[model samples]
Target: MNTRIAALAALFLAAPALAEAPAMTVMPSPGCGCCHAWADLARAEGYDVSIRETDVAALKDDLGITPGHRSCHTALVGGYVLEGHVPFDAVARLLAAQPAIAGLAVPGMPSGSPGMGDDPDARYDVIAFGGTAGAGEVFHEAGR
Candidate 1:
């Protein structure tokens, strides 16, 4: 009886840790301040983030991120690629939905985007790419 109680307590204690979100691996362009800021924001939002400085151009090319979809920083999480300063909510949606595509992108450093600045009026789209034809579609929109 005591053993059963201990087993139950252990399981309950471990449940939250087991359910934690997967770690995010971020590769930022060397010397890019915005990329570092974005990573900091992600960490503040409770994401388990790891950073690596690298040549972003080569990484983008290797990842098949089209020229139009390039960003200063790239991240890999839960088997999906995240390019640029994508908002945490967008990432959460992507993970929850697990859509059949390559990944999400916020494209260039748009003003008001995360790590860019707090521009309440900044408008941009989170683009989802690498589907059947490698075309991009709007995954989510932000800042009106």
Candidate 2:
């Protein structure tokens, strides 16, 4: 009887820690409201989000985000870089799939993207970069 009680208590105590979501770090341009908005969006979606403000140009360069792949903000999640306002669902998918890629990028900020606005109909592509000589391919398409 005592053994059974101990087993049940152990399971209950470990449940919350096991169910905790992964953490995400976002580096956004200083004074960029949209970037903050996007961070809030990620937090709302169950990410343990942390935001840091920095020079966008220098940060982008440091992160190896070239001109074509540049965005207003950058994020690190599960060893992958998430550029711009990537959708929450796409992030969830990326973490679930655990693809062999550097990370996902949304490039420019689309009007209907997660932080830009709540437009479910907005069209965009989440790109996977850094796998093949720095070449990127589409990872997810919105409104498809």
Candidate 3:
């Protein structure tokens, strides 16, 4: 085999075993009941979740999420921001794809979003927000 081609083959062979799954850090207000509920849901799904209370506004700023894109909570997973009531399944998909996105946000207290509990007829959007306020696209939209 050509030396350069053999070296390339070796590198490719070793890549898969070194890959690591992405993890997210969840930050929520201490007294927020819904946040805890969301945390529980994440835990049940095998995510490495760490809970802490901090100034949400400051956290948002630290993550570079301006006021227009801010939500009730903040999460950091694999260089992605999980703002607000994002569901575990969607989060898993996000981590799996590892898209070029600033973060995933549910925005506001959506009636049936994860921790908010089940809604027989709830509609919400799992929006992917990027660098600016309008740099957002719908990843998932829940419906009745």
Candidate 4:
């Protein structure tokens, strides 16, 4: 009975951490394997990812992912739009800080980016856009 009580206490202590993980819904272009790969990466990083195959172009437009900062997949998490293959760390930071920004984007797909095959040499910028239709501001640069 003491062991069982200890186990129950451990479970209760861990519940809050699990509950704090962000839930994300990703919309990827239909038949885009890379987008699927990206979504998988997000899941591995502990996000609750729900993927849907739809018209990504229309979705991007609707979400205000401007042409200059568009990618194959778009995700909604913590009330912010994440466009393209955004890095997991950036997402975590965004959620933790709850910045007043539109979202983060990787713009065009870079070879070394997550889900695009990690090519350590491939550098890319994660841009943060504010408001519903804000422009890109460099948030973080990877591989630098």
Please give the distance, in angstroms, between residue 70's alpha carbon in candidate 1 and its true position after superposition.
0.4
lDDT of each: 0.77, 0.74, 0.67, 0.73
How well is each residue in 1-144 modelled by candidate 2, as lDDT tens digits?
Answer: 123323422422332321266677778887789999999998888877776656668656655677887788988766667889999899888878877676788888889898898798999888887655334888889877
Please name the candidate that would achieve the greatest lDDT relative to the true structure: 1
TM-score of 1: 0.82
lDDT of 4 by residue, 73-99 (tens): 888776677888888888887777766
lDDT of 3 by residue, 1-144 (tens): 223323422432332221243344567876788887887777676665666567778667656666766667787665567888887667777767767667788888788887887563578888877744334888867762
> How do all models score by TM-score?
0.82, 0.82, 0.75, 0.80
CA error at residue 33 for candidate 1, angstroms: 0.6
TM-score of 3: 0.75
lDDT of 3 at 87: 74
Each model's total of backbone clashes: 0, 0, 2, 0
**For model 4, what is the error of residue 48's alpha carbon versus the real structure, in angstroms, after optimal superposition?**
0.9
Give the lowest summed-lDDT range of ten residues in model 1: 9-18
RMSD of 1: 10.5
